[model samples]
Target: MNSNNEGKMDVLNNIDDQFKELLELIEKEKVSSFSMKHFDRLKKKRKTSKKKWFIIGFLILTLISMYFILLNEQLTYNIYFVFLSFVRLILIKKCVNTTEIIKQSNITFFNFTKSIYLNHLPVIIDDATDSWPAMKELTLKKLFQLFIEDPVLAENDLCYFETNIRNYNQAEGADRLFNDYINGKRRSFIGQWNNCKRETLKVIRSYYNKPYFLPPSVTQTLMGNWFLVSAGFHKGTDYLHRIPLNYDWVWLAQIQGSSLIELRPKHPCETICSILKSVTLNKGDLSNDCFFLAKESYWTR
Candidate 1:
């Protein structure tokens, strides 16, 4: 009877063990469910935050736009008063008005000249990255000052310099910034004039730097004496006509602080690499085989 009781006790312990295992399993499942629910809720919150921010931004933009419309009405009225004041001043300031009148006439004439001469020039060719803008590219008025202040440039060269700078502003894709930059003139028109001045300076520099090419005796004789020059023509054979390359080219250009100097092209996109390989400049030469073959067509511009 004692042995039978011991066996019955063992069986009871085994049953208890099974029950405990089942409880542990159930607890684990419950924990997993809670974690899953938390993950789902967190995902929802992230989605909601993104949408909420978007809505807030949209509302802010709408309010700002409305404010501008209201402001524009006042601005338009102010412009009319300002214009009227200008007209009265023009009528009264005869000397001031006369200078302005002549300036306007000159501008109109310059525009006409650009329409004829730079007809082939793309409007989108923006200004060069000139570091010394004031001294180098931004010095057209200085040209007028030169004749007034220092030596004089030949009439023909002087004319081209003036016109080129004027037309440089006409470069395509630069209308807005051009107008914003110029002051003491119509915001829109004046900026274009300033841009034109800068562009003209770049073109003038490129023209003068034609390799081994010198101007007429008068120009050579009067180097610094001449302020500007017309780029007549460059050797077509020196460079390939076209270089077919898949490249976003950013040229290393020089800017001066009241100075100008000649530099050679460092990157030879096509055949120029081969031609300039032998012609090294300042220890940097655009001489590479694959590059030269690529630009194997017309080289001169």
Candidate 2:
């Protein structure tokens, strides 16, 4: 009986040592970077419409003829003369109007491209740490990528977005008017996510304009199944500010523990869930399943 008891004790000691080794491994290797989705949407250029000189030349001629010849026509006297006069007047307007339109479009496009380029983050190896300014640019980039990709999954990520957004197939400079509208409101909406996600191409980088925050409204709009990210026992303060991200109701997993764990819902939707899905929670203070996994890592004692 003594020998049996001693053998069991040795087995238990070995098990404890193994557990410690496993814990050490988790501490060293748990950090992850986002590499699952190979985003290439940004590579495809949204072709810009070029200036149509033919239209401009035609407009010039129309205005010249209208100003010199049609201006003196008797008012509403001959139907043909009246029509020519109207055509010339319209041509002049088109020429002047397209000028502003083209300029605004180019500006809006420039800002729009910048906003998209900064969204994808090269996933970092140490995932558990982040500060507002420390992760500012990286956060902005990752959020932008996520913003575009989510839209693609929903199908609205491919349309061109702008002030007077012309149909993608249009040639008569329809984009002119659209570009004008967007630039006119640049600071308020150009590198915007909520307004553009629904109308943009998938994962085209629409979230980096502001580094500290991702749009909560986008997540709030989701209606299907989702995973809820919890901060576990850690109540939010500045570090958990990312929790309020607006996503749809998701499934929940509760974590509990002492402290030191710095991960939580990066948005409100990351926390707000419709149902309690599954939990990787353990018997300690700091823990996370930031990744969706069945098996969990946590303290037993």
Winner by TM-score = 1
List model 2 lDDT by residue over 208-232, tens digit each. Answer: 1111122221121211111122222
lDDT by residue (tens digit), candidate 1, 1-301: 9999999999999999989999999999999999999999999999999999999999999989866744564343344334533443333322221110011111232452233112211111112231223324333333333333332211222312122234443434232222323332322111111212333334334322211111111111111111211122322122212222222111111121121112222232221211222221111111111111110001111
TM-score of each model, in listed order:
0.24, 0.14
Q: Which portions of model 1 miss their true places by more than 4 Å? A: 74-301
Off by over 4 Å in 2: 1-155, 158-185, 189-301
Q: Tell me the deviation in Å of residue 172 in model 1.
A: 38
Tell me how far candidate 2 lies from the true structure as C-alpha RMSD in angstroms.
38.5
All candidates: CA RMSD (Å): 24.6, 38.5
